[model samples]
Target: MQTIQTDVAIIGAGSAGLPAYRAAKAAGVSALLIEGGPHGTTCARVGCMPSKLLIAAAEAAHAAAHTAPFGVHVDGVIRIDGREVMQRVKSERDRLVGFVIDSVNSIPSGDKLSGYARFIDNGLLEVGGHTLVRARSIVIATGSSPVIPPQYRALGDRAIVNDDVFEWSDLPRKIAVVGAGVIGIELGQALAHLGVDVTVIGARGRVGPLTDPVIKAYAEQTFRKSFRFEARATVESVVREGDEVHIGFRNEAGALIHDTFDYVLVTAGRKPNFDRLALENTSLVLDDQGVPVYDPLTLQAGKHPVFIAGDANGVLPLLHEAADEGRAAGANAARFPHVTPLIRRAPISVLFSDPGIAMVGARHGDLKPGTFATGEVSFEDQGRSRVMLKNTGLMHVYVDRQSRQFLGAEWIGPDAEHIAHLLAWALQMKLTVDTMLEMPFYHPVVEEGLRTALRNAVAALQAAELQAA
Candidate 1:
């Protein structure tokens, strides 16, 4: 029973914990990181990286399929070896894991231990066997786990989650995805392109409902063509019968339908992973859903010197937001005054589906009447967009009509993720529309779309003024 003392003990060596480890060490604080699993977080392992690989393979297959129509025909000789593709995916995943390990190992005074850790008392954690660690402060960055509905949990090898999708050596023949959120839609489309009969079921109006409606419409349009997009539909149940998985769902029309598939993937949502942490002994506040409650500004739990960040805090579950929260908590825990700025700069959320969706600053409902105005330009009109063959999709800009400051922007089409950062930076800097519209951008680029969207906003302001006068 060796007892070790440290200045800080950080739990979970994912995105948030990794950054917190480095920052704490830089601030001259000795920290210990405890992880139950691997080094990299969800984004590196299960979430962003693997999903994007699936999407890239899907896009390549789509291009190969369309090559015949563009005068380059391979004449009936094309095949995708699922096993080989999966091997490549694993290679990429391993490379990212190596990168994370290198970064974490670079922290001078940070230590990582592998085992499920539990809170013994205030600022005390028990890892592995009798190794007790006591610190002045504790940071919980345990992150999240995939959501599996009760009805589908019994199907062992037939039903899967996004986390297990990468482990399959072969793609499913017919698959049913049980959520229309970011993960489900992205993976569903990718599988559909890989020759899988993919059907998506969701009790929502559209895919990626949290995104701007305009962006949602674009995703719905693009994805519906390849996969069965069943919106406002509820999945009744899924049962494994023989070698197939049987799925039942009720559509918006209240009609019960049944289908059989080789696999069924559930991506409803993710909740915090705190079951084994033994938080009951400590004063960490937990919500009804078992998620830790922490002050968003300080990332500190209400009762103890312990802090929670990332998905554990449940403030904004995105990876970037979690990293920002972790950095702030680590810096402040080392006696530096922490500031949680009023996220006036809208953090852009991007869904990298076939036609990517990007939204910055404020959603449509976040703006106030008379304070803000919106202007949009269709992707059909942009020369660069036309060349890319994306004649659909929309780009929307929100502006403070009175102050002429750009509030935010959202776009769904090519280069959306890269284009979104410009608007986010502008909103963060409180830049006026006049300032944005004056900046010069290169021609025949998606960036020019930003300038065009801002120009349209300026035109709308002028029209409003003329009518008022």
Candidate 2:
């Protein structure tokens, strides 16, 4: 058995783990990154990068086909080569992975070992072939895995999850996407645009159910025009018969209707990957869902010299949130006096569906009875969205009616990701609603949509007061 020593041992090399490795090195701490698979985070590998590439290719093909309606006529048939699309997706994934490896190797500190990382006890990690690595502090950044329902496990390759969806050499002739969450809706729409007969099945009452109602409605409308969508359908089971995968759903009449597809893509949400890790051997406590429980401020797991970040902590599941938590964990692990951290600001979430969905701070449901005000603006008011034919989206702002401080912001529209950042920063800096109104934002741009949303919030707040009087 080989024995290794480090100041900090980081498990998982995804978004959170990689950043933690860098943070530890920057603080002059000896760190070791333990990854179960090849380098690169989910965003760089299967989750974000490949999915977005597939969407981009699909959108391009759709655009080319419709170019004739826009007065651009081409004599030839616009075709989609699924094999070629997968090749591009794989190439991009490989390039990004290579870049990450090169950067990590160049660091000249902290080594990466490819293997499953498990906790032998507090502050000790067992990795690849009986190699034991001990550190003064351990950071668990093990990400999450797709949640596969028991009924669909047998379908395996025929009915795949996001992890193996892009591995196909050719896209399916028809695909049934289960769970109309962000991934399912986006990929289903993209596949439909690429000429695949795609059907999106939402087990919930509506698509994008975790999102704001306004965003959810807009997404449903957009998806309706692109592919077949069924909401509030409960899936009983999935069966693979011959070359076709059949999904059974209970309709409103309580009768099961089976729909068959060449393939089935399941986006039923993801579960933490910590099950393989022997966390029971350590002092670390896990929640009922098998995720580590950590102090939201310090991200510490109990009194043990171990920290949790990323999906493992289950604090925030998004990639950016994982990276932020990782940065904080790594820096604190390397700190001398035993560190404690404060929540810097609220977390933000962004979805990459057509017209996108971005949210920062809290939602209306998260608020209690208080002197609060809500505001919204439509993308119809934005020149950029209007020109891009993306007028179906909306921007929402929440503020304290009395203090006028910015509370939160949510948008589902063009450039929502970029706009959310500014809103998040403003909220964190304690910028008031009046301050945002006075700020200068470029006209004829998508960014200006936020300003309009803020204005609406103010007006709506005043209107509510007038009604009360």
Candidate 3:
């Protein structure tokens, strides 16, 4: 076996790994990047980019067919070519993947290793019996993989994950998506808009990432009107009969429903790729979820020289979070024993569904009772929303009752992606509800709804103050 020594070793050359490698190199340390699989990132390969491409196609079809309100008439049926839709998705997906591969290829050939690595001991790695690396520090940026429930295993070829969706040459006629999280809702609704029979099943009455009960319920109701959405579902059996998959479940209303679909798409969740790393050989402390107990600020795993980042850390799995975590971990690993904590940005999440869903700063469940007041707005009556014929949405802005500062928000509304960013900035800046109301609001725009929500919050705060007095 070949023996090598490096200052830092980064496992998995995906989103987090690439940035970690760069940050360590920038810190004037010799770094090695190892990959056991494809070089493309989850976002570029199967997560964000391709999913958005598919959603774009879905949006186009939906727009064309639903223009009757604007008095625009299409005499004939609007036809969508499944082949063409998939062709664009695959073509654009490959282009995005190619760019990432190019970036990976630019690394010095000697610094890149093509093998899965396991910890033989703290800071010691064994790579496929071909190489033994002794590193002063290591960063685990190994990303994650789809978690397939045991029940779905019986479906055989009829069951698939998000990674398998972009590879299809043609879209299926019917698909039942299990788990109504971000991935499931985005894809399920997109497929439904594309003329497929889609049913999205959720458990525990959750929908997307919204924790606010009102917003969650509103989102559930709105989506059900668009497609068959079973919130708070209890799935009983999953079986494969020849080419089709049969699913039986009790929905929210306690109705036992049986359905057959061409495929069962599993979007339950993802598992971090740390289990294969032989962590027992290392002295890092792990949590109940089997993830390393790392400091979020420093990305350091306990008292060890190992750092965990990205989806491997099992904390925020989004691409931006992965990049930030990777950079922090790599820099800290390079300057071991003198690690610095990162000043993390305010939390923000968005789902690119129709009437986009977004959560910024703290979640609704995280707020302390008697410490917060909420402001709400309904787009159904908002001027610009009605004019655009996209007047279906609900938003709630949370504020500190005492300090009157913006705390967080949950939203399902038009232009939420943009509005969420504004809210996130307000949270990071610690802006007050009164202060946000002072910001300029343009007339006849979606953003006007935000102003309305803020004003509503101000009124609520006053009402609470009066009752207290």
lDDT of each: 0.78, 0.79, 0.93
The sequence of per-residue lDDT tens digits that candidate 2 reaches over residues 54-129 is 8899878877876654578978788788899888988887887787778667755437677897778776778876
Candidate 1: tens digits of C-alpha lDDT, residues 1-469: 7888888788888878877776677789888888878776788888789878888888899888876545788778569878877887877987887888787677554376777788898778898876889888778888888888788889887778998998878887788898888788889888988888999987766677355676566667777898998878987877799879988889989999999998889888887888888878876667787666766767766645667777877667887888877776666565434434323226778888766777787777677766776777777778887776655567889888789888777677778878878778888888899998777798888777777788888888888778779
Would you list the clashing residue pairs of candidate 1? 346-361
Q: TM-score for every candidate vs. truth?
A: 0.93, 0.92, 0.99
The TM-score, computed over Cα atoms with residue i paired to residue i, of candidate 1 is 0.93
- Name the top lDDT candidate: 3
- In candidate 3, stretches whose alpha carbon ends up further than 4 angstroms from where it belongs are none
lDDT-sorted candidate list, best first:
3, 2, 1
Better of 1 and 2 by lDDT: 2
lDDT for 449 in candidate 1 is 72
Q: Which has the better TM-score: candidate 1, or candidate 2?
A: 1
> In candidate 3, what are the lDDT values of residues 1-469, reduced to their tens digit?
9999999999989889999999999999999998988889999999999999999999999999989989999889899899999999999999999999999999999899999999999989998779999999999999999999999977877889999999999989999999999999999999999999999988998899999999999999999977898888999999899999889999878889999999999999999998779998877787787888889889998888888999997789999999999999999999998899988899999999998999999899999888999999999999999999999999999999999999999999999999999999999999999888888888989999999889999999999999999
